[model samples]
Target: MVDTDSVTGTAKELAGKVRGAVGDLIGSDRDSVEGRARQVQGTAERAYGEGKDALRETADRVADAGADARDNAGRYYARAEESVRNAADEAYHFAEDAYDDGGRYLSEGRRAIAQQVEESPLAALLIAGAVGLGIGLLINTRR
Candidate 1:
């Protein structure tokens, strides 16, 4: 594509140069000046087009590199998120096991307390009455 444009621009420049030479040979000053101006304009335009093409190619390469970097970052972020989720799941299971063990310990303590209470009914009754009397006194004091 670039080669084609270069060749076409070169052809146009050659044609303008030929036209200017012919005008000079024929002694037409106006035609000679106009043809020369056309040749110069064509040369400047070709150079500008080549510069623009170079800038566009550079911009495309930069954009492609940016896209690749973004894709790599996304992949790394996904892996990091998965790692965090797995860690959280393991922590949750550990907490659940600890809670279950605590519940079992509390149940055993309650059973031991019940056995002690059954072996001393008279002591339990006296303790309950004392607690009730203390609550009544507290309520009366509040009033």
Candidate 2:
């Protein structure tokens, strides 16, 4: 839409042209100069109006860009948050699985040790005594 000033300026310019033409027909120097001056004023007002329109358009574009950027940032933040939560859930499941595996392995190892000790009680007792002696010697050395 054309600015109000632009429309007004156009009307003024048309009037100025008519006035200037009449002055020329009547040979009036003062009217001729006045008409020319009015034309200049009209041109200037039109330019000012056009400039204001351009500035308003530019501001609107900038505002749209800002809103778009904000929306994009919000979407990115939401995606990032979802990714972190997913990773945390994966880690929790992985840790739970590892704990379960460790407990199963520990139970199997205990059962194996019990079986071995039962099969050779004397040998297990001898090995335990040797380990205790070695630990005692190590403690004395450290002290």
Give a tens-digit lDDT track for model 2, residues 10-120. 777777787778878897655655565566556655655665565555555566678876566556555654554565455445545554665677689889999999999
Each candidate's TM vs. the true structure?
A: 0.46, 0.51
1-143, model 1: which lDDT tens digit per residue? Answer: 35343455566667768877987899755455556655654554455445445544554555667887656655655565455456545544554555466567768988998988899988988999999999999999999
Q: Clashes in each model (backbone N, CA, C under 3 Å)?
A: 0, 0
Model 1 C-alpha RMSD to native: 39.1
lDDT score for candidate 1 against the true structure: 0.62
Give all candidates' CA lDDT scores. Answer: 0.62, 0.67
TM-score of 2: 0.51
